[model samples]
Target: MKRWLPLSIIAATLAVAGCSKAPNGDTNTSTSSQVAKTTANEAYLALADDYFNHDLALNPISATYVGINDYNDQFGDQLTDKWLKQRHQLNKGFLAKAKKIDRSQLSQQLQLSYDMFVYNRNLDLVEETFPARMIPFNQFYSPLFSMAQLGSGGSFQPFETVEDYQNWLARLEGFISFLNRAEDRMREGIRSKVVLPRTLVERMIPQINAQLVQDPTESLFYAPIGQLPESFSDADKQRLTDAYQSFISEKLTPALLDLSVFLKDEYLPASRGSDGMWGLPNGKLWYQYLANRNTTTEMDVDDIHELGLSEVARILAEMDQVRQTVGFKGDMAAFFDYLSSDPQFFFDTPQQLIDGYMGLKDDINQVLPDYFDVMPKADYEVRAVEAFREKSAAGASYQSPAVDGSRPGIFYINTYNLRAQPKWGMTTLSLHEAAPGHHFQISIKQELTDIPQFQKFGGYTAFEEGWALYAEYLGVEMGLFEDPYQYFGKLSDEMLRAMRLVVDTGLHAKGWTREQAIQYMMDNSAMAETDITAEVERYMAIPGQALSYKVGQLKILELRAKAEQALGDKFDIKEFHSQVLLTGSLPMAVLEDKINYWIASKS
Candidate 1:
């Protein structure tokens, strides 16, 4: 979603109600009542475009990620107390203005957009009550990691021109400023008695030090200098090199060093010992809002926790059948051990492992047409995760290609510990992270030239992650996983999501300790210890994000089953998938309503 902004994560993870002065060139809506005058659905859409464009300019990192280059040299304001206040005012004003439009007059498509915009605004207002900004930079997600990706010359930030190099020099200034402000914000968190878990702080300190390079030439920021275009004149190249050296040493390095010292010497000493959100003020209610936002459901914690427990048990019974099929003579725990340590199940080299995923591409392509007609035009490539981020990053994630096709969509396979990436998980991992999962769903959204920008680029976490998880199960329909070991891999991946339901809720809502959550995961699945540890810490660092994957997947599966039942022979898999992908990511309720309408029409 960087095509949108890394800062957009702030907007995504916490839907804070915000208000700001509209950027220059926004449609001049002189009064709050003006929305009523733009009643033609297209006019209303034009206004939505204006509002979204204003956001793109505000979040320049997002602009770079999404391929909008106007703010390529800028960085969002660090999460200052002032920034937070303005963001609140901005959201409140927009929500109020949008409310002036007559929803009854709009076409069905515009109506859906209108309802989602309003729902998101209201959700943001609710999120304004939390202290998320306090713990801004986690091991999993932080400005540090995002900036490293950009400066390392391998990510969204372009370095094809001298100005591109200069643009980044300017952007680094903003990032350096943010690091200082980060310490200030965390200090405030300390004073307010809101602090991150000790486990997360332990992880974050190393992340900060890893970026604090003393020598200019040795910096990851120096990476682009090495790759400067051959077209650059000798004089220009020398000048740019000197400038980058100065910027990294004089400006960036000191800031990183200061951040390193502050986090270790000051912040870490004051961090929370508790592992769950239950340790914070109004923690229960805080976790509740997160749960609702992630799942887009009002289900009680007990219900989600119970659902997780039930799913885990059901998946285990299936795992036993796989064990028997593979001719293992032991119970589930022994099978888990055999799968984890067995040489046959582990790849000897990273290239061999990557080759395995690449090989799946041909097999996947053949079966793809039978299950669905819609596919993204964009080509996707599989690559190992960049060394800088491989450790903390999820096993695999799909970054959408630049809509303009300057870049190919990348499937980043984390090869940190080859064993953690079990051979059994490869097929399902490739499906979920590469084909017909994130790449298919996300690329389809960006390719939607006809939809409103907010609809095109915006997302509901449950809907998006849920769609990817649902895609993993789609493997079976495609006749993948004929090998019981591979089918068990699919089940193992499915079990991980089910376990997320239990541990995410258990840790955040049910007072489960970090160790308790880890133990529960170990008992339930054959996931590697490193993977399990990182995941538990991730849930701790970000409370309810893990809940979204399973919650969204189950809903899609249920809805698909409903469509098949109602339409009988008329149900077409291709059309059903096309509807899901073409509509873009949506809230669970909105998606369900849309699907139900299709079901009725088919009947």
Candidate 2:
């Protein structure tokens, strides 16, 4: 759910030196070395701008959703083979263009830019073999659900102008084509034995069903019409209303029904019963590639699994201390059962679930400065996840602030199941999702002016997500997890992340069955049955992504420990944090190199 507008803003204004000839034909000569440096810098900057602008134009809806309102309502022909070819060619052209520039002539920021361009180009080399577009929709992330967000009146689609309303109508037409293409690709997947799990298909049924309401008034997609601009005359309104009805009845509804039937009747039956990617051709190699891309490391599955096991064992021992402090007359397993089944910790109502998180904002704000410095100037808010996508979305997720400062960073707490939002988990969740976690990391990164646009706005999952997971540990230092049960919640959360390293590799690399992975989680953590099922399914949908959190957290912690030891008395937590944040998110190896430079400089 990382938005692109902030990155666009950063990249948009990055000025590079290039001089055009005067209309008067006055040629002011400069030193050859100076001219060469300027040309090189300008060439690099132009390439960066080209990449950014091309990306923004191609994914205009993404641009709009991320608060880049210039291209307010648009979506590309994401389904066409020609579009894919163009996208690949675009990347290829940029890569070739970037390589011709001299890196040594540019500033440090530009050097990072050159390196990232090359790294991404290398990543593109592996993309063709993966066939990611083949298996697009799952229970977790899907373009269908994303379209609903934009079409829904409360989100990015501007309703104040008649043109805006018409813009969406055009966008929906484009989306219909994309969805059809998606279905075609998925059919290919069916033949290839690369389909999603049956469980995921079943989950998607409800999402499609929600769009099938016979009454246009009650449909979620009707919101735009309901809240259409007041500037529209009655004639215009009536015309729009008629057009929308026909579009829905004739186009949208049919598409939804077709997709739903396809999922239930065609795709589900062919889906591999097993959860792991290991069942596919070269699955182990595929997973290794994903791990490298996700964590930016060469650590193999066995290494990650072993690391997870060690971390899980260490966290469980800490949880045992919490049980002892509570004076519970039970074994660790029994205590875990007690925690899971107890209604005392559960919220009875959805508002209470939301209020519980809302309350934490004030409580944590008072203690935020205690841990480190560099807070985001943009305000933050908490809201429940929208009902349509909440069922499949992560328990809690963060959305960054708008680049123009019009929208605040949003911490969306899922209230789909009240039982899932336990009171004890709120503190750690808030810290991770709001303060010092995603909001702190992302917003501050966006605010940085010293770095290149790509570095400032770009992200590595391991660095960004790892830092968020690491933020949970910082709760202990902030004096937020003072209560033993709350402290145990932190350990339980850590254990879940550790479990991901094991289960993600288990599913993709080790050929572990879905049931087997779920059982492993049940045996290891205090997670509820509902939570465990959701987590496993998420890993199945997006392999190796979950691994980044734990891998990144450990790296950050290692570097922090190294900094504190190396600098000794001169070690400043604020300065250390500032250094980490100043670079935005980088690959772990790159992050290590950057931090090492900081450490050496202090000496």
Candidate 3:
């Protein structure tokens, strides 16, 4: 979960190899070629800059969340037709100009810029086909929930000045407008037969109902009013408080009521009964497109399914070895059940869960240098997932540092369910989400000097998440998986990712029910039923995203083996890792190409 901001342009001047002739007696031919090359570089860089700034302006909240404060905390008016047209036109114009740039003439970094821009444009095209706004209020990862976060105390919203409070007031009004537009777009989805799953709609009912409680003072959004800047005059404070109360009662409550009524009355009944994407029009084609887009490869659903099965078999055999070493008196299924039900492995309290991860930071730091040559200068911290969103969040996740260094990278452990946060799982989780995992890969990429901002900060999920998953494997080499139970935990975690490959495709491609997907997971792995249910629902909420981790990890491992075989004694693990991290995040295709080039250069 690295925070990716929109791409910015490079301002470097290029040096050309030759000169040109002048109109005068003095020959200037030698300088003319250099001037032309410099001009071309400048044009490309300028185009990138324009595209980046324009994108941030249109999606201000996304920019803010990623720590791009150019818009200074303003939110977008997503409801207005004028805003929608402006956003579409911005993408179109950038794509048109980007197409004109001769990619072959640019450096490798510039070429990546061209490719990412094209990929983003392609996404824009497909995005129009799906009516995502129709089912916006999921239990996890909703824009509405994010809005409450930004406006609440103890978060990013600044309340130091009167102007700061006023800024939020303006933003709140825009949020109301955005919700209205979301309702309109969902209505369109209802008509188009692209509604959300009924199960997801049912889950959302409690969330919407919770917001409708009659006391504005007790509402989460009221925190801003309660904590208004101390510098404000008493008169101003009273006026602001009264205004917010009125706004919440009159405008915000009605908006929430309208949205809830629509979801319950108009949208839920029309929601799709089937869980898979294959139920939609052109579903097979749609899923194929998603598979390629997410995996960053042309491999079809069948290929991915087979790959997952093979990996699952291999990891299961490894898990069995751990069972025997511990002298467990049962088969693999019994071992899994023992692992799931064992009380000694579970955390009793959430703080104990948080402390376990906090202690690992130093332990990992001491051991990381043995396996990785490149390390991030950016620091990291461990924290519990925010209470509001933790129930639906992944078991553990990472948020990358701000490009400007204002914020540290965060490893958020979900402490919502202490039973789910096993002590044995902590080491592998730490390795994947923190040191030498996401925090290492993402922060170092952002710190690179020679690449364009987009390549530095932009992320392909397969590359980012896959690299993190692969990082867990590296822990064994670093001697972190010493305990047999911890080793079992590593394999268990890998199995979960491998299962994602099977179950995600099963849900979105093979038309698996939510229960069917959950059952597949329970039958295969040691995860709790509660965890399996959460994961399956997450896939339903955001299709094609879960498939990236295992897919990307396999590709990286494949490349490493190839490099090791080719270079023989010349293969330096540190150097191989340096090459990968130095290039920043790339599509799997581009990553493979870069690795191939590195291999050739070594030869």
Q: Best by TM-score, which number?
A: 1
Every candidate's lDDT: 0.84, 0.81, 0.79
Model 1, runs deviating above 4 Å = 1-38
The candidate that wins on lDDT is: 1
Q: Supply candidate 2's per-residue lDDT for 329.
A: 92
RMSD after CA superposition, every candidate: 8.0, 5.3, 4.1
Candidate 2: regions farther than 4 A off: 1-39
TM-score of 2: 0.92
Give each model a TM-score.
0.93, 0.92, 0.91
Candidate 2 least-lDDT 10 residues = 9-18
lDDT of 3 by residue, 313-407 (tens): 99988998899999999998898888888899998888888888888888989987767788888999898987767767788888777666766
1-603: candidate 1 lDDT, tens digit per residue? 213212332342233213322345233433222333223454557667776776776677888888777887888784877777777876788888788778775655567778888888899889988887777778888787788788877678999999999899889888877777777778989998789988898898787788777788988888999999999999999999999899888888888888888888998899988899898888889999999998998988779989999999999999999999989998999999999999999999999988999899878988888877888888899999988788888888888888687787999888999989989898998899888899889988998765678887889889988988888899987888899989999999999999998998899888899999999999989999999999999999888888899999999999999999899899998999988887688899988888887887777
Write the number of the candidate with greater TM-score, choosing between 1 and 3: 1
Candidate 3 Cα errors over 4 Å, as ranges: 1-35, 70-73, 79-84, 133-137, 153-156, 225-239
Model 3 weakest 10-residue run by lDDT: 1-10
- Enumerate clash totals for all models, in the order shown: 20, 0, 12
